[model samples]
Target: MERDSTAGGAEDLLLEDTVSKLRAGSLHKHELAEAMEVEQEGLVEHQPLEQDDLNFEKWKPKPKPKRTLHEKIDDLKTYLWNAETKEFMGRSGKSWSLILLFYSALYIFLAAMFAGCMCCLMWSISPYAPTYNDRVMPPGMTMFPHVDVAHGFDVAFNASDRSSWRKYAKALEAHLKSYDDGVQDRRNINCEGNTYFMQDDLEESAERKACQFKRSWLGECSGMKDKDFGYSKGKPCILVKMNRILGYLPGQGTPVHVTCGVKKGSTEGLGEVQFFPENIFNLRYYPYYGKLRHVNYSSPLVAVHFPSVPYDTQLHIQCKLNGRGIINDSPTDRFLGSVSFTLQVGA
Candidate 1:
């Protein structure tokens, strides 16, 4: 009986403890709710009551109203002309003068620096000799009577097309005009062929021997024989001349000559090519002095004739300078010692 009564009392004590713990948790929640409500009320009172109250508080500012056109014009006028500050374009007269003086001094200093740099560069350069001759080594060769020079020395024309052929003829005439007998007389010397005309120092005459490359050497292609230089007749004339460098000498007596042929494996339309001046750039004309030394210097020319070119077909022609000291083929240089040109004759 005593054990049963003790068990009942323990169970009642456990139930009372649980009920007290639940009541305490409810009181904590109610206190937290009151604290949160008090904090919210305080925040609300601190907020801006009137618009004037916003002067001291941080908040999103109201958007400004759009300005009228007249108001904007008035603002612009005020910016341009402020009589009180005695200013124009937002800058006072004194400020503008100071800025102008600063820029003027800066520009003057920069100009002086540029002039000094140019003077130093010129001092490094030699007037008598070239800075680098790698590109100009063995010199360059040029083919005259160039037509349709869009890329390198390409000539493309329709034979039946009169305008196209006429353009080519005119180009040839203009090129030949420079090689006329009267022009050559003024600038060239009656050089002795088959020998190198070498001049070590500037002579009293101040001239070097310029080879007389007569138009007669060109035969039918010469402007004298055919005014169109063979372009009208579908057979075109090409004149090749080497660019002269100061004190450059080719192999003696061997002579640099042009070797022209249709590209290998090409169509057999290109036939019986003829070269004038015997396909030779004679050694006598070489070792040219500059324009300053030789005032009337003329370069020697070799004329090439395409006797029969198939109509309506393109002919790939290779014209190479064959001689010692001349680079025949270079992958890096496209137009160093030789020149390649395309000829498309259409009917």
Candidate 2:
């Protein structure tokens, strides 16, 4: 009962002091109203704000502290010397050795597999004959005095231009270099000009008689007779050689000849064309067996001459090779057994 009286006395003194403050106008009317509102709402009394609580800068996000070089080194050292592992750099010696060994083994296995595949491929392929004769079926034909071999039989030049005409002459001379007598003697023999020379075995002489394709047979265009190859005289000569395939024969006693003429509308621009050595590729040089068997074998050549051509005009000429088993009319094979060239002359 005495403790209750003491508490009542203290509460009374507090009420008396508050009322005195309100009467003296020391306490604001809003404060008195707030105190009454708090008592009526039964809300807890608000504590006074601390200096730190009032400061707004303390509420902002702190920046991350930058690590110094020594701190970074220490962290690296700690990571390297962890409880479970110790490493020279980033990995343990054992880990590095294992990685190297795995890579070496993988490389060795890959190399062996590649070598085995190459061996299998080589075993299936033949050194003598091609596996697929896609381009070799009809035999590809080649022609000299070609402006560009990549462009396929398209030859054009100014008649008065020495440098332009000399290119063709140089090409012809280089092509005929393999026909030296000493070189021909090693692989070729005297063949009967009338018949096809066929050899079966390597017993007597493995070489078939290659026809003597003398440079003089080209007449005035032959380098032996005319060194300029008839280029400067407005008469440019062209040589054609058929690509040889092993065991290919044009047939028995069927002669292959080349025929050249101006195209339909180009006759006015170009005059008559003449062919040398009777305009034929004889059967004696048939069935060319690579460089190993017939080292000095020469393909029969025909030189076509454009005797006269008018100045400042382009002439289209078509040269057709007439023979058995040779394709002359294939649209895809423009230069197969026949070719077309445009000639231009200027003063």
Q: Report per-prediction Cα RMSD to one decimal.
A: 9.9, 14.0
In model 2, state the lDDT of residue 112. Answer: 100
Stretches of candidate 2 off by over 4 Å are 1-85, 149-161, 203-212, 251-253, 266-269
Query: What are the per-residue Cα lDDT tens digits for candidate 2 across 75-139?
Result: 88877665457675678889989999999999999999999999999999876556776654465
Evaluate model 2: give its TM-score.
Answer: 0.69
Clashing pairs in 1: 159-346
Question: Each prediction's Cα lDDT score?
Answer: 0.78, 0.73
C-alpha RMSD in Å of predicted model 2 compared with the true structure? 14.0
Per-residue error at 210 for model 2, in Å?
4.9
Off by over 4 Å in 1: 1-59, 151-164, 203-209, 266-269, 291-295, 310-313, 344-347
Worst window of 10 by summed lDDT in candidate 1: 200-209
User: TM-score for model 1?
Assistant: 0.71
Q: Clash totals for all models, in order? A: 1, 0
| Top candidate by lDDT | 1
Question: How far does residue 57 in candidate 1 sit from its true spot (Å)?
Answer: 14
